[model samples]
Target: MNEKNFEYLRDQVKYTGFGEGLESELKEKMQQQEPSFSLSHNAHYGTDTATVTLNFKKSDQSDMYFFNSYKVDLQKDNSKESLEQTFYINKGSNITMKEAYNLMEGRAVNKDLTSKEGQVYNSWVQMDFKEADSNGNFKLNQYHQNYGYDLEAALSKHPIKELDTAKFKDDLMDSLKKGNVQSVTFMKDGQEVKHYIEANPQFKTIKAYDGNLKRIDNRQTKDEKQSEGQNTSMKQENKRQNQSAEEDGPAAPQEAKKRKKKQFNSM
Candidate 1:
């Protein structure tokens, strides 16, 4: 077995959110020198359970192995039917296990994706549950940075106390970007109320929930409304600038909007 190749695969599995428990199994499989193999893991989040299958394949030209993709079979505790999605691994940005669970649960995740030209760009990706491809994979909707969904600005609309502190605010943003429904304290009428919030990139807002996870109206204050108006104007100007840039340069690729119709199964 190639020690260097083994270490790379081990780190990939660990960083991908499977943890270090699979290191032994991964090492054993690598030693077998198979053309390809897969590892299965069961993860639990709240009442929902997920079975993640990680796919690996040996390089044709070298002794290296690649961690290609993963399929998530998510089963909610209350529901009999489960949803499954195959998330492809890319050299740029790959979603973690928890992020996959959140996406399966219908939440958006922020990622820094690499373009074909090797340029890094930020986008918020969410699965479209209403649509599916030929392989039963849900289509992904990407809200690029040009779409004007400012997460920080959205969070500022609410009286969230967590945003007051630099460290707490950064942590909350990181959690929300990972598609987690983060718990935060909302100051309403000078009283601190506990709430849960998630990033709603498509709608360019933050969704708030009560302690019981019930959706509540996140009414904007007068100052917030004024701020939103200004933001709207700025977004419009930015949109115009982006349109001009696109017109001046080559057309932007539509690969993000396209869905492959090929049939695939979990190995």
Candidate 2:
């Protein structure tokens, strides 16, 4: 990539808030004891920012982020924006966020974090759209701020690994767009009751609850569960009716007698 392009992306990155608060205290205490390493990188592009926080676990492991946590703000302004990408670090889920930063430049974010210790953790990403309205058109997959950085064109000549975020933001965005078997929400009156209603994608969710506060299932899409409702009970009911004739009489006997009479006449 050209120097201008590189500088544009570099400006979005800041090592600020590094070794702050608990990290500072822990590192200070560790220095008195043994030694440790920790990592924190908060990348900002446009109005959105991805905050990285790696808590300390072992000594001399300070350079690496342990028990990682990542938070990606959909909008920079906090009080108004509610949609965010968040994930907690767990066993075998720890990975790097280098790819995630690239994604902010219109690249892809990896799904796991890698450490010098070779430990892994699941990057369980959740896209919180609780504050989004039915008319909201915020797309998570697309890069919100390119900042004159033509990352797509640059990758044609350079290796993508150079910009790998090694994060899970892309996976979460893909899953949301594909409408995976993820949790949706419902509401009661305006209280927002998060119970029941797989709320199939058959319809667009306007409000979680109606004016009366009842959970509204506008039911715009039909899924497998809806198909399951179409049982063979109708056919079974026909057979039962034949054995115990209803007011309309035995349907099978009438057809059977007609068949026998037709055979005798032919003979």
Q: Compared with the true structure, what per-residue lDDT tens digits does model 1 show for residues 1-267? A: 999989988988889899999999999999999999999999999898998899999999998899999999988989999888998888867788999998988899999988888898999999998899999999999999889999999988887888879999999999999999999997655567888999999899988898999997767432444554565565675576566657756533232112111111211
TM-score of each: 0.81, 0.24
Worst 10 residues of 2 by lDDT: 198-207
Error of 2 at 23 (Å): 12
* lDDT against true structure, model 2: 0.36
Best by TM-score: 1
Q: What is candidate 1's TM-score against the reference?
A: 0.81
- Per-residue lDDT tens digits for candidate 2, residues 205-241, read 2212333445544442122223322333434545665
Angstrom error of the Cα, residue 101, model 2: value is: 7.2
Off by over 4 Å in 2: 1-29, 32-40, 58-79, 82-86, 90-95, 98-267
Whole-model lDDT, model 1: 0.85
Question: Which of the numbered candidates is closest to the native, going by highest lDDT?
Answer: 1
